[model samples]
Every structure is written in structure tokens, then in C-alpha cells.
Target chain A: MNTYDDVERTGMSTQDVEETGMSERAVLLDFPGADDLMAAGRVEPPSAQALARALAGIEAAVAAQEAGHAAGRKKGAVATAPLRGMSGRRRALVGLFTAAAVAAGVATYTNTGETPTGTRSETRADTASVFLNDISTVAATQSLSSGKYWKTHLTVGDSYLSKSMDFYVVNDGKAYKKGRQPDWQLGPKDLDWKALNQLTTDPAKLLQLLQTPPRPKSISPFDQALTLLGGSPASPKLRAGLFKAMAGLKGVTLVGTVKDSTGRSGTALEFAEAKSIGRVIVDPKTSSILEYTFTWTAGASKGKATHQTYLSVGFTDKIG
Target chain B: MKPDTRQHEERSDGAPSRDGGSDAQLTRSAAGDAAAFTPLVQAYSPALHGYFARRMPGAADDLLAEAWLQAFAARRTFDPSRGSARGWLFGVARNVLAQHLRRAGRQEAVPGVEITDPWQAVDQRLDAAALAPALRRALAELPVEEREVLLLVSWEQLTPAEAAAAVGIPAGTARSRLHRARGRLRDRLAPTGPAGRHLSVTGDMA
Candidate 1:
């Protein structure tokens, strides 16, 4: 038997291979056509513009790391601060200010014309709220469509749990895993096709529904909202309502445009609580959730990020 | 069968120790020195860009940029003790490719059918007309993992060990895969056979 050792020893020298009685050499050299395949696969080097952009991106990341290190040193904290890159941080701050302004505007609109100290509050609108509202409007414009089944393909990864899972669910009235035969349920709070379709499209009502429940304390209103957004075959109006409701949530803040795991760029929204942080990436054009990630901010699982990418979601007649 | 001289010159840790600079540069870059990363980028960007271009021709530039940013962010995780920086970079590229494919709703490996006869599974997607038809058919029929290893060696010019590192497989597995792929290709392309004669005529036409 010709072993791998004999193959490696034959080397890349044709002359030496001919002198040595190695069958592996003949195997390696017989495919002269491989050279053509290699030539065919050749591509031109990256253009100067692409190279420059890549360098700039790297430089920004470096600068962000350095800044994070400096901040950590000044605070007497560990040098493990999250590196949001310079551009991302700037965008996040801008989004925060916008969200804050929008909250103030909403508060002022609902104000009874006086505070505890009998002073009137000022009204303002920030960027993130406006962005989300705009997205909601676009989402509402999406034409409603339906099929026999609502199909979703999702990939989930959790660093804290050290688990990776993929869910391909096709739901008509009942949920099926991958196809019709096998029954499926997605976690404890899973809603069936009927529950999903019956979800009220009213933004305020949707928020109330998500908040009211005998749910675990760990499943926050935000988490519930995201779960529905990801798993449901909600109509265009419902999706718009979901975004509008999420926009009003206390801790939800825009993180600017960021790419998901799949490399498709989308606007990112983050909600940081006492123990964990949740982030959702939305394709504003279609108002669809591209990805959702949650990371523990404190305790044993601190800094471990779990994420789910919604590869696709659509209505299909057949389940597979 | 020309040996890739660069692979031979690499240090045990996998960093090219040609001038004893890459390892030091990588360390400095990981320490947040942006300037140190420039040389490393210049050294590997062409091959890395090619890696993306081969699989995803249209979005190669954007994918390359994304991969570099990711690599820079994760630079601290690159242990020279495990593999060379090139192998590490290629691994990153592979990940980027996987992500891109996932977003596009495509599988990296074409599953299901086990190609027995090359003619039955000729991959019409490949545009390499200059390559022998029989060999191309044989290649298209090779299992995705074996094909990946073979290409990383024959095209990317990585040794079996380096290819293993790039593909996140064991060195022994990579060598055996390479050996099997070579033997299969030779068998399919043997000149004395009637199938081989038919393939040669078709190869010229192509």
C-alpha cells in the first residue's frame, strides 16, 4: 500500500520523482491539466481603492482599541472593554442622542403641562426615533401576502452555552421541523401559526400583549418582541407595529449601520439591561430582522455573546 | 511539481521567518500598533483577495475589506504557536466566505448525490475550458472536503500541513485526502483507457 509518507517524500521535483520508484509521483504528475484549472481560477489582485479602504478600516479598529485601553486604564478597569470601532462608537452616540430627544418629545406630548416642581417640559425629537419611525412607515407599505405555510430558516449560536443550533420550521396551523411529518416547537415561548397570525397589528396593543404574561423574569418585553419578530409570519402591519413598539422601549438604542454575520449590512439596535445586552439588526428597506444577538454583561457568562441569523423567512405552499 | 519555496522557509510556528519580521509585526499589531499591520496586509492581501475572488467574484472587494477588519479585531486570538499568519488569514477568509454564503442562502458544500461517473456530474458552472474535460469532471465529482484540500495545495500552493491549517482539519487527514484525490484523478485520466481517449477528444473541442 502506498502510504501518505511515500506521497510526501516524492516531493515536487519531477526529476527526483522519475529516479525514485514512487507510484504516488505518477499520480501527482498525471494531472497536467491541473495547471489549466489553476490558471482559470486566477484573479486580478485587489484594486488600489479596495486596499486603501481595508487599511483605513484596520486603522480605525486599532484606534478604537487604543482608546478603549486608555479609557479602561483611567477607570481602573480591566483592559477588556468592548471594541466598537471608532466609526461604530460615533454612530452609536449619535443614535443615542436622537433616541433621547425622541423620548423627550413623546414625554412632553403626553405631559400634563406640569412637573412635580410645576415646570413645563421642553419637546424634542432625536435621530434614532425618527429613523425607526421611518422604517415603520416603509414596513407598513409592504404588501401583505400569504401561503399555505410560513417557513423560516434560522442559525443560532450561543457562546455562553457553547451551543449552535439551526431551526428550519414550516408552520401552517401546526409547526413542523424541516418538513410536515416531524412536529416542532421553538423554545418555551413559541407561538403557533394561529397565534402569530392573530397578533394585533396595533403598536400599543402589540406592546401590551408582549408585556402581559406568566412569562419568566428572564424573558423581558424586548426579548418577547424580538422572538415574535423573528419567528412569526406577522403581516406587514404587524411588523411595522413591532418596530414602532420596540422604538418606544426604554433601553432600546440604535447602534447605527452594522453588518450581520452573513455580511449583509443593516441598522443595529441595542437594548442593555442590568445583566445582559440585546442587539437586533434590521434591514430598514424591508423592515425585516436580519440578525439578533444577546450578550451577558455581568455574572458568570459575562462578555459571551449569543446570536441568531434569520437566513430567510417567507410563505411557501410546501414544507421542506 | 515545483515545491513552494515559501512554505519551506516558514518557521515551526507557521510565521514566515524569512526576515524574522512577521511574528514581531503580528505581536505589535495585536498590541494596537496600527502601523505594524501594514506590512502584514501588504504581504498577504493579494493571496487573500484571490481567495475571495475565486469563490465570490462580484463582492470580492467588500468581502476582503470585511475579512481584514474582522481579522484586526480578532488579532489577539492569532496564536503563532498554532499556525502561520497566512494559514490564519485564509481561515478567516474561509469564515467570511461561509458567512457570505449563508446570507445568500447557499450551502458551501453541494450535498446529496455521490458522483460515480464523471460525465454524469460534470459541473457546468465551472468555466475552465482549457482544463481537460475528464479532469474537470473528475474534480467536480470529488467530495467537497477533498476538493478543497487538493485546491489549497495545487492552486493556493500550500503544503498539506498548511492546507490543513487553512481548512481547520488535521494534517494527517489533509495528506490522505490529497493522496486519495490525486489517485482518483490519475485513474480517471489514464491514457490507455477508451474513456480516456474519448475525454481527450472532448478536451480538445472544449
Candidate 2:
């Protein structure tokens, strides 16, 4: 009897028998007959040694992460992460390079402790150095491990620029998770250096544009928390307005030294400029700004060249 | 931070396996508790392996390893109230797999290892072994969503609810798709004549 005849005799519906056949056929075709494939030198289930090796890799990774945490604790790493904001100026500086160029720049600057030269008017500085100069202390820094960092480049009439943000962090050695609430208000979005640079490359035009701040459609959670906690980053025109509003507020200074368990110590300093322009952080000991950064962009507009500088402060603990 | 060390402490502390722990414990484990997550790793590794192995052939081992690593690195992001630890883990694994595929720029199938059904073993009129590969190819030919639903239920052995959870689809939609996929497969395997449409073998179909 044919296949269907046999199914009919066995009291199976046409559909049911067909399903059984199809499932079996798929298994048969998807994998060459295991016995045949094995005979032809196919590897069977992963060798036990391979599995052990995999488990070892996992165990090592887990151990390293734990050790990092313990080391952080010993260094007086703050469990409470501060509001680390990416100033509009800092973003504009790095967004002008391609991915390859960005990678090269990050590698050179981070490894040699020197800044990568770029076409922008300002001298290139390592992101950490910029933070140190702006903030007295840095909480944490980890390079992108997933190779997913996209790089971009910027240019005006004669100048082309390449930049990179090799390491990202908060103050006092507190690691920043993407979605966590900030201790103070930063911004509503996670604008990378590239996106920022694009906005501010022309400082004059940027200042003009800032007269009416562009509203981002979606804001990140970190920015949301930052807004709730304290001051916010405003448009250039609004920033000027904020400085005017908080002009009478007393300016305060904060300073502190953070030493990781590894014996790596960095100093942090914080300055409340106008309360509304927000606070500026700088490493008094290293004379580096660990967090706060500013960039000015100038693009031609209305037949006149213009420039605008944006100010942002890093979060660091210091007494001033 | 080793799971072994954590395991020892939990034993001494008289805390139950993490799967049996309160939400707080699960949350802590997700944050940075290596020891707290040991049970989670043990519990879900098999299911995760099975999940990948059934869909993409030969990927079971690598995907499993990557999934575990991702689960740990991203442990902080896990939201316990939204779903179970296993469900969250499977979601991460799927993302990781998608990322890997996108980066690698190659779509290669890892051949599956076949397991025979015991009932079919006793009545060997039709060799199921001969049918498996054909079915697999046919399944591949189906739309990705339909094939996913079919294999999720048939190969991965997930009930409709569990399958829906894995793929982030509604249960009823998944059920309907599964039915259509199976029906499509059957039609392809043995073309049915219009004459056969009148017969309803199971009183349910009429």
C-alpha cells in the first residue's frame, strides 16, 4: 500500500499522516543521517574537554567581575552614582570622525596619555583628561567592549576633524549604568560627542539656534533622573539666561581624592558657576577636568561667521 | 564572586536555591551577586541550549556560552517583576544571537542532531529518519515567523504559552500561526485532492 493507503488502513486522517511524514522528513533532510555523517568524520556532541573549557572561561569572567567590585568597594567607590552629564560642547568635539578614525584616535590617546590632533580649532584632549580638568574626581571608566561604538567625522570650509570618547564614567568611581537615575539633573538624552559636535560646530549659529532649544522626541532615563535631582543643561541662550537668574547664588567649591583599590588615585574638584550654568568639575591634583567639558562650533550663517561655546560640568567631590 | 564560593555560603547560610528565593534575592543576584545567580545559570542553561539548538543547527554550544556571558554582564538590567529569570535570559540570548548574526555577515545553518521518537520506533513502517531532513528543508522554506512557530512547538517542545513567551508573541496568535504552519507543511508533503475535503475524520473539524 502507498503511504496514504497505509494511513487510511491505520485509521489516520490524511492531514495527521502527512504531518508525521513532514516532521520526519525535515529531521531527515536537515541533518545528514547522523550515523552516515559520523561515519564520514563528523564531530559528535561537543567533546567533554570543550565543555569544561567553556565552563572555565565562564568561571574566570565571573571571578574577574567580582574582584573588580571588591576592589571598587575598598577604594571607597560610591554606591551612589552622581549625575554625569555629557555637555553639548563635549559631544560636538568627538562626533566629527569615522569609526575607524575614532578607534585609532581612542587607541592612541588612551595608550599614550596624549590627545589626538584634529582639525577643530581647539586642541584634542583625551576624554579622561578633559574630565579631570573639569571634575576633580572620576568615578569609573570602561572602554566599549563590544566593538559597537560608531564613529563619525566633522568638517567646515578647510578643516576636517576626528575624535573619540574612549572611556565613559561618573565621579567618585561610581559606575554608570545606561538606564539608572542620576543623582542630579544632566539632560534628557544620551547624545554622544558626534551628535553634540554636529550641533555646536558653528558656535554663533548654535547660539542663535539655542534661542529656541530643539526639543528631543525621546529622553533617556538617566537624563530623566538627572533633571529631577538638580540643574539641567540648557540651550546657549537659555544657559545665558540661567547664569543671569542664579547670578546672586553663592558659588561653592568641593574637592576630594579617590583611590581605587589598585592604588590608582585621582583628585576631583567641583565648582558651582552660576548654579544654573551648573557646576564645573576639575581634578585639582592632576589639573584635569574629569567630567565637565565645553565646545564651541562656528558655521557660516546669514553671510556672517559666528562661534558659540557650550559649558558642562563633571560631577566630582571637592571642597573649594 | 565565584558561584562555587557563593554556593558554599548559601549552603551555610541555609538559603534555598535561588529559584526558590524571594524576589529580593533574585534582584540582588541580578545586580552583582555571582553566588545568587548560580542556581539561575544551572536552571536555564539546558532550556537555552535546547532553544538555540532547535532553531539554528550547530549553534547550541556557542550561543549557550554567549547567552550566559550576556546574562551575567547585563544582569543589572534584568527586571524580575516583568518575567521569570529564564524568560529574561532567553530574551537576552535572542538579542545576542541577532547581534552576532548581523556582525558576522554570514548566514550558515548548523546541522541538528536528531532524536528518534520511541512510539515510531516500535512501528517502523515509515522510517522517521528518512523524513527528518526533508521536513527541515521544507520548514526552512516557510516564512520565518511561521517556521518559528512550527519549530518552537514541534522541535523546541514549548507549549503555546511558553513559545509565545520565547518569541514575544501573543499566545492566541502563536496558536493560530502554529496551526497554519503545520497545515501548510502537511499540504506540501502530500497534496490533497478537493475530493478529500468533504471527509471529517475527527468530529471536531466539521
Candidate 3:
């Protein structure tokens, strides 16, 4: 009998016959009792554990922030905590930020429309604050300023991290390799460790370098790499610290509310970008973020992605 | 994942249970109705659990917990226009599973074991004993992809489209896989041994 004879026996449609032919070529294509297996197959959920860990972290941070607030109140040093960027850069113009908050606050901005304006901490000045403004002006005048430096602290979701920079405007300045000590090398090929080290130590020297461009022959590949990492991309969403660094005002954007593991209410916030995109889970009643995450993308190409690495950051109120 | 304890005062049959609307349900849940979400949990939990267990390690409880937590955390991003609430929950849980596996560094193919003797379960309703051994041998011999497609369809009862979704393959691929699998099963059960050398073209009783 012809192979076509079998296909035509049941008077089946041409499409059905073709489908059957394709499947017949592959062994084990049609499994029996697929329904029962699917019904029987079930997996336990893991969100509960993750949520618990996150809540513990949030509680610790909130408690710490409160204690610090209490201590600041006792010292009469303006109990308001300062706002910071993703990299923890404080606003150079605190007075302006405070004025904007006060204006919004006076207007009674609250739960209205899709997004609501919330309360902001009152502003105050310190040595670090004054230094930040100077650095801002330098950065503004020259994209790459010589001998300028700035040190700032940043908080992600609830956990805090630190960043420091000694800015130098090297017209042809070379970058140093990451994690290399200044005394480790010398010569024309080796960048001056003394000058490179100034960004981390001497703010005055850093500022001076910001004013003068470095010789082209002294530039290093390591320095070029650092510039690339710190450089801003085209996408606004990808710039984690851009708005806050430029505006000097950090604010929370409330997307909406969600229920948590304990059957309690919580708020969700989009706090990261494609490279580290994640949502912040916060206790709605307390207005405290219990946990957050940094999402990492992976793929063969730098831009295209195949998988993700979700790094969850749990916080406690005590650490804040 | 906190067991969604919200009490949904609605009936099934794909009908709206409340006079107010779905928005009211969301609002009430958002407003701290811990029990308001109970109906939703109960209804979708079985489906979610079943979906994951068939292919993975069968740790339904743990997977369900993760899925539920993900659904709750991402509730705000849930847009009603795209799909059903249950479907949205599934999407969220799927993402959670991907994250969980990545964190554990245990990304590998965990194939489901084939039931050689369906009668081993001793179910009085099914005469699986007659068909079990042949089915088992046939299944075990099939290629991994084919076996998976077959089991998910016949036993799991997932529609061809849904099965395709789970396996992360196209429905057309799943349909072709199922056909090949069935043909082999039919050939193996056609009674081609010693004394029973009679070919049963009926495609049963090997």
C-alpha cells in the first residue's frame, strides 16, 4: 500500500494528515495520560521564604532610622534624614529642594490622581552639603573637571551603599586600573598614583585637576573603562542616579498596593532599571519598604538578554 | 506566600459574583480585606500547582507559595485589559520560578518519570493493567521531547495550546510531537509477539 493510502484512509483533512505525518516521525511525541500527569504535577511556592527574609531586613532598617532620628532630635540637629541618589549623591541645592517640598506640602498634595505627592524631610546644611554644591557647579561648568572630588552615601530600597570620587579634568588624562595602588607602578606609561589617589583623599587636588586637562599620552585603558561604566546611556530609564544627582531630590513613586505573604498590605515600587530592574515591597501601613532586588540580565550580546539574575536585598528597620 | 485569604463573595460559572464589580474586589483587597482574596486563591491554586508539578520536582506546595507571593507583590502591575486575573497570576509565578532557579544555581532539565505500570496505582476504574506495560515501554523508549509532550497532553489533560505554553514551545510543534508519540504507541500495542503474532489493526492490545 502506498504511504498516501494510510493518510487518506480516515478521510481526514489534508492538514490533519500532514500533522500526523510530522508527529509520526518523532518517537514519543504523543504521550498517553497527559491530562492526568498535568493534573498530578504541582510545585510548592517559594515566595513565602523570600518575603519573610525581606520583611526582617525592612524592620531592622526602619528601627535604625527611627533611633537615628531620635538621637538627632535629642541633639537638636534637625532630625530630618537627607535625600540621596541611587549612588547616594545628595542634592547640591538643599534649600531649593526644601522649598519645592514645602510648596507641595502647603498645597495639601496627597492620595489623588494616579500618583500622589508625599511628605519630604526638612532641609539642613553640613560640611558635606557645601562640598556637594561646589562639585555640582564644577561639574556643570566642565563635563570633566580637574582636581574636583565628591563623596556621597546612597540607599537602595532600604539598604545603604557608599560611592566616592575625586574628579579630574584630564584633557588627555589616562585612567588607572581598578583596585591598583598608586605606589604599585611608576614611569610615563604608569599613571601617577599620587595624582590618581588624590580623588579618594585630597579634595583640593581633585578640584585642581578638574580645571586642567591631562596630557593625551598619560591616558590608560583602565581609566577609559571606568569612564564607560560611569557614562550615561541614551535611555532615561536606565539612568538610575541621573535625576536624583541632578535634582538633589530623592522621592518615592507609588505604583499601587499589593498583599504580602502575611496577608498584610504592602506597596510596590519600580526602583531599578533593565540591568537591575526590581520592585520594592513595603508595608503599606508603615510606609516602609521591607525588601528590594537588583535584576541582572544575561545573554551573548550586551544588549540582548536570555536570562536574569534577581539579587534580593532584605532590610531591617534597625539598620536604617 | 501568605495564603490569599481574601473572601470573594462570588459564584463560579465565569460570572461576576458581586453587584459592585471586579474593581470593588481589588479595592477591598487593597483596603486590607485579608479574607477577600480567599476565593481567588482557592480557585487558581489547583491550576498553578498542577501546571508546575507535571514537569518539575513535584514540590507543589513550595512552588505555589513562591508563585502566590510573586502574584501579590506584582499585583499593582496587573492590568485587567490584557488577560484574566488567574492568567496574570500565572505569569507572575512563572517569573518567580525563573528567578528562584537562577538564585539556586540549579538550572537543568528534570524530566518526569514515565508510568510503566499504570496499574501499580491499583485504580479500580481503569483497566490500565492491560495497557500499562506496553504503554510504559513505549513511553520509556520515546525521545525525551516526545515523551514530555505525550505525558502532558494525555495524562495531564492540558489542551495542546496550554501544553505548548508550559513546554515553552509552539502549539504546532506540540501537535506534531503528540501525533508521532501516538503512532508509536499504536504500533507497539498492535500485538506483534510470538503466539499472539496477529496484527490488531485496531491499534490496541499489543
Candidate 4:
């Protein structure tokens, strides 16, 4: 029978169906043999593991919100809470760091035979140095894992230029955009994976490598350092050296703890130049780059910021 | 005849009768009650999970988790006065799917791109299994806007008004699109006999 007959069989006029909702089965009855097609399109329900993970995420999120509310109540003003009320995850991280610092203090005393000094206030420069060094120490301990391809998923947001876009670039022997075709010249440099792999991990030598030609003269040493840290699969030792080299750069300063674009909190370090300012947020515990932001300080694009959030990065056997 | 209030009674406003107390639960959940929110998650997780799985199989779990997280963060913004919570949730899922496809550089899979067929993957599956090719072709030929409305109704089991909420269109517009889509599919699938010929002439007249 024609589709009209099928609808007529439902005993409701088309207008009646529209004004008042039709039954689920009646909705598809107008299309001939749609039941079979709909059945074919059905997929199995979500795995129990997926459901559990989703529930756990919701629980953590709700807990964080509750903690924020409690802190706000105790402080009498909501504004004061953010200053002292870290998320459960961040509080745990702080506790771990405190324990690590005590252990480091004991080691210093045993090795050098001197009493540990009392805590003192630090200048911004000292703070930046100490933070970078802590990240370097963590980075150095990470064991390298290998796979067929090094994949980096990044979301790029430009405040003035255009809308934010997310894209992934994968590198094997050659760089590929979304695992599609070879991207010969990506970013600022004509990236040669072979050359990048052979670069020195010595902090002093890496600093020199970043300063020389083939690295564009216009891009600051700090910006180039971030590009290497973010885009390439640098070994843990190399990553450690890069952070150390950045610690020595003249214009680098700590922006303190801040949340990245994806709302994950991390330590932010800013690098100021003549015409632009650049910032990179790092998850110090894991020594992974969370975000990189660049803002033009002069000319037509002044005050406009470009934020690139590093969503996921790792070596994977397959790319898609 | 008295209008069928059966479907309307279930999904009239922010408070659906089928899942009673959801509106109150949503409000409590927004107020930072995790326990109140657990029921909503348990109720909708299966349907939302299926929604993602059909579109992007491998990344479905991650996408589902991300969608729920985003939904929770923005729960305060959900106004039940406008539409059903279920429809609003599906709207969020649609946006998540679009963002995912865009991130993956799969422009063709992104919705609102009318010319490019978004059903190629689903079509291939049907084709491989030697299932209804004619119906599949008819569906694939429907414009993205109409096909989306139809699928939201047929597959997701949303009412036309609920589908309208999901697609971010007016209820009237969604109904018309549903009407147009069903009409076209009916025409295409009609048997090629004198009856079909007569129906085609009538369709042309309409």
C-alpha cells in the first residue's frame, strides 16, 4: 500500500497527527517499511564500563560544585572562596607536593650536613624558576612509550581573527593532517621529523639550537621552545631540558595557577616580548602542556589572543 | 473527536508525566544535589549512549561522557518552561556530535551541510547486509534538515514538538518538515503501476 494508506490506517488525519503527537509506531507508519530500517539502525546499549565512567565523572563534578558552595558559605562572600577553595583533585596534588618537598628537604640535609632553612616569601622570578624546575623533575622520571604514530589533538581559538577550531596532526616519518594526506610544511617551520628527533637534549645546547637560524629570527626563543615541547614527541629527558632552558629565558614570568580553556586548572607561565605576549599552562604533576596562548601587544591586532588547548597527545597505533 | 492528549500528557511542558518528578530532580541537581541528579543520568544515559554510538562508534563512550559533563555544567541554564529535558539533552548531544566531527576534520559528517550526505556510513551498512535499498536511497535523498527531523522522530522516538526542540526549530516548522519528508518517501516507494501513476499525478497537482 502507498504511504498515505498507511497513515490513514492510523485512524487520525494528518492535521490531527501534527497538532497532537502521534504514537512512536504511528510516527513511522507513514513511511513504508521504515520499521525494518529503524531496527537495522539500532545499536547495542552502552557498555557497563562506559556507564560507570560517566556516573563517576558526574559525581566528581557535583562534588567539586558542592565544595565550592561550602567554601563560599564559610567565607561569607563567593568571591573569596576561589582564592582558598581548590578542587579535590588540586588539593590532593598540593598534599602530594608537600610530602615531596619534605622528602627533598631531608635529602638535602643528609647529603650536605646543614639544617634546612625556614620557608620564606619568594619573588615572582624565584617562583617561576622553582615551578619550572619542579615540572622538569617530574618530566625526567616519565618513561617513554612508543607507537606507530605521534598524534596531537589541539583546539585553536583566535579572539580576533576567527572562530575556534579543533584539528589533529599526526607524525610518523611524515606529518599527516587528521591521518589523511602528508602535510609537508606545517606551522612555522618546514618540519623535518628526522632532524627534530636528533636534536640535543642538553639544556644549554637546546637553547642554542632554538636561537640559531632555521628557527625563524622573528619568533622568540621562548615561542620556539613551546612549539617543540607541544608538537613533537620529545623524549622525557628532552622535555626536561626544554623546561630548564625556558627557566633561563629573560622575559619568562609566572602567571600563577589558572584554568585552561577546557576548564582544567594548571600553572601558567607568561613570556613577554617587544610586540607580543605568549603564555603556556602546564599540568605540573604530569609535566604535560595544557594550553598555549599568544596575544599581539601592538598594531591592529593588539589585545587579541590566540589560545591553543592541547586536548590529547600521545603515540597511538592507529590514527583517525 | 477529542484530541489525543496521551502523547501531550507525557511531554507537555518541562514536567513530563511519563517520568514524573524529573523536573523537580533537575532543579535539585542544578542546586548541587548529586543524589538527585543520579536518576536523570541513569534514565537518559542509555538513549544518549545509543545516539552517539550510531554516529561515531569508536569514540562514543568518550563523547557521551563529555556531553554529560557539559550538560551538568550548564544545567542551570536549562529552562523547562521552553521544552522537555529529554529534548534539551538531545540538543546537547547533537552539538557534541557536530563538534567531534569538526575536530576530526570530517566536514561531510557535520550537520547543517545539506548537500553532502551524512548518512553514507549508515547506508553502507544497510547496503552490505542487502537490506531495504529503495528505502535507504529515499532517505539518503531527503534534505539534511527534513531527514534530521524524521530520524529524530523515528529513531530517537521523540515527538514532533520534542524533535523541534532537539533541532532548535519551531514546532510548526518541524511538523511541516516531517510532513514533507514522509510525503517524498511515500512517493518514491510507491509501486510503478497505474495506481502509482495516478498517485504521481495527484502529487504533481498538490
User: What is candidate 1's lDDT per residue for A1-320, written digit by digit as tens?
Assistant: 11122233322333455456444323443353555665555567689876765654454334434443444465555323433444765654544454455445444322322332211101111123434555676566666887765666676421110001223443444534432221112223355556556656787766556555524567777777777676566787787887676655555554556789999977776767789988888776567889999999999999999888988777666645
Models sorted by TM-score, best on top: 4, 1, 2, 3
True contacts kept of each: 0.33, 0.05, 0.09, 0.34
**lDDT per prediction?**
0.58, 0.36, 0.35, 0.62
lDDT of 3: 0.35
Q: Estimate the overall C-alpha local distance difference test score of candidate 2.
A: 0.36
Cα lDDT tens digits, model 2, B1-206, are 11222222222112232433534544776545755655555545555565554344345565565556555545655555555454456566665555444333333332341111111111121132344554434444454565555544443334454456556777778767666655555544443453133223211220
Each candidate's interface RMSD: 14.2, 15.7, 17.6, 14.1
DockQ of candidate 3? 0.06
Q: Please give the lDDT score at residue A218 for candidate 1.
A: 76
Chain A TM-score (model 1): 0.53
What class would a CAPRI assessor give candidate 1's docking? incorrect
Candidate 4 local lDDT, B1-206, one digit each (tens): 33434344332122343544666677677544745776777778877887777667676776776667656655655657777788878887786676555544554744445221246565665675466777776676666788788878666667677778877889889889888888777777765544345344534321
lDDT string for model 3 (A1-320, tens) is 01111122232322553455532211222223322332233233324543343333233222322333344455554424333332322432443354344334322222112332221111111111211222222222212322222211122111221122222221223422234222211113233323333322122322233223334523222222122112211111111112113122222233334554444454443432334334444442322233443344433333442221112222212222
- What does candidate 4's lDDT look like per residue over A88-135, in tens digits? 667545544644553353233222212222111112333355455556
Identify the leading candidate in terms of DockQ.
4
Q: Which candidate ranks first by lDDT, i.e. highest? A: 4
Classified by CAPRI criteria, candidate 4 counts as: incorrect
Instruction: Give the 10-residue window scoring lowest on summed lDDT in candidate 2 chain A.
Output: A152-161
**B1-206: candidate 3 lDDT, tens digit per residue:** 12111123222122332323443443344333423444455445555554444333333444554455334333444435433454345454455445434333444343453221122121221233233554455555555566556655444334454456555567789778777666665555444453123223323331
Top candidate on TM-score is 4
